[model samples]
Target: MASWKFPGFLIFFTLFSCSFSYTFTITNNCAYTIWPGTLAGSASPRLSTTGFRLDSGQSVKLTTVPGWSGRIWGRTGCKFDTMGIGNCETGDCGGKLECDGNGAAAPTSLFEITLGAGNGQDFYDVSMVDGYNLPILALPKGVYGGACNATGCMTDINLGCPTELQVLGGNGYQVGGVVGCRSACEAFKLDKYCCSGEFANPNTCQPSYYSTIFKKACPRAYSYAFDDGTSTFTCKASEYAIVFCPNSNGNQKPNPAPASPPPPMRRPHPKGHVVPSSSNIVLLPFPVPMLLLVVSLSFSFIVERPWPVI
Candidate 1:
């Protein structure tokens, strides 16, 4: 009986540990096919397949052990031969079908996550810091915490991307020759735009004109390096569904209306002072009651204003 007890306990422990593993259900809702790529962080384990073809309207589920950390992005306009040697229009990884350990190229939107162990909260975000290739929506299911809210960039930013920062697609690509939107850093390679060198810290680095455009279009996504106040999300989810080109269902939040004009570029404050920048503003959705109250007040103030004689 004593000998049997040890084996029974061991089996139970293995099963318990396995239960903590999480699943990522990647779906392609775009009209065309896209190859999804996965890149594990330096300290994390690689997934089963580094990359694979995901046809339109199809979905694939990948499992990850507890505490996994990685980034996933979609590759478009790929044409690989039998040998799996080829390139993609956007988000290519060393011109290969399987990324292996390679990361996605710039001008690619990324769904980045670090899963928690056991019941710990997971941190996740959809980042455009590299740039924008395709719109993505990440929805967490079976959330253990109250903070599990859907987040992603659902707007096709390429339509409004500046000419200088555009990535033109090849012969078969869509959207009038433009495909991806390059980051200011990718377009100019300046330390001020890249948030490197003298501007490495948040106090010294603020959103540039270009990043502000992305932030306005996709308020919940990471537009630049220091866009954490509104972009980062945390939850303890059993699984996450990452949908590429998500359809305009009611679940998806509509993009905010275009602002009158972007704020002027903010110069970094002198070092050692913690001045707040636009990137630090928390732009989360307001509760319905709060939103209504704000609108009512604004309307009342406008009505009360007296017209001045010209």
Candidate 2:
């Protein structure tokens, strides 16, 4: 007699099949300048592809990673290093409020604006990955009111950000007081940042276009801004209350990702079994060949059995 077992031959043997597919969209929340030069990350820009870059009024449809995350955008001018980042420079300051960070050229000042949230009660700094902190916003044709008046206060003034004060602090290593406003503004809120209604009202002011925000930072001290060690702003903060302009206002609740369910539990097995499936099975190419002899003999005996045979 011979014995054999074929996957628990339940009341009967049956066939089955199944298939599935998954699709997704992605967005990168953090990344470096699209390109870097002799300054820092000049070796490779691969890790820099994480975020998206847009000019004054440009937009893009993100499709890499999905879900909302904090993001930064800018339109760098001359620092347009073909393979490097152009730091603060005079030639192109991305319209003044931003930095051009070019190696050879001088730093140039461009546009500046401030945006706030709430009644502009209390303002906070926008923290950056490297401890570099700031608030952000986008301004159009930025403006800068010159030297603080005799009272160390510049009032109701705007002169499209000054190229004179435009300084790139990132590469220099160290600078003091509130760093001059970097060409870019930290993300911020409209209510948090504000200019005196007395300063020019948005509606009344002559703007190339409207900036999401436009207000001065530390409007008390001589109002002039100074650069910090990290290419950040402290205002002539030490000199006087620095009143730098800004654009970003990170005032809203940053969006969050929905929680994902834990993956299905799988049991441990001595040896993983190959699940049978109707779709994957080739109709005749099974272990049937090995069972051929046994099946034939069983059939012969059943056919010749006395009870039903003549």
lDDT on C-alpha atoms for all candidate structures? 0.70, 0.19
144-229: candidate 1 lDDT, tens digit per residue: 75646677877777666777877898854456677788888878878888888888767888988777877878877777777767
Q: By TM-score, how accurate is candidate 2? A: 0.20
Best by lDDT: 1
List where candidate 2 sits over 4 angstroms from the true fold: 1-48, 51-53, 63-75, 81-310
Candidate 1 accuracy as lDDT: 0.70
Write candidate 2's Cα lDDT for 43-95 as tens digits. Answer: 21111132223322222321111111121222222243454343432223232
Best by TM-score: 1
lDDT of 1 at 192: 85
Error of 2 at 290 (Å): 78
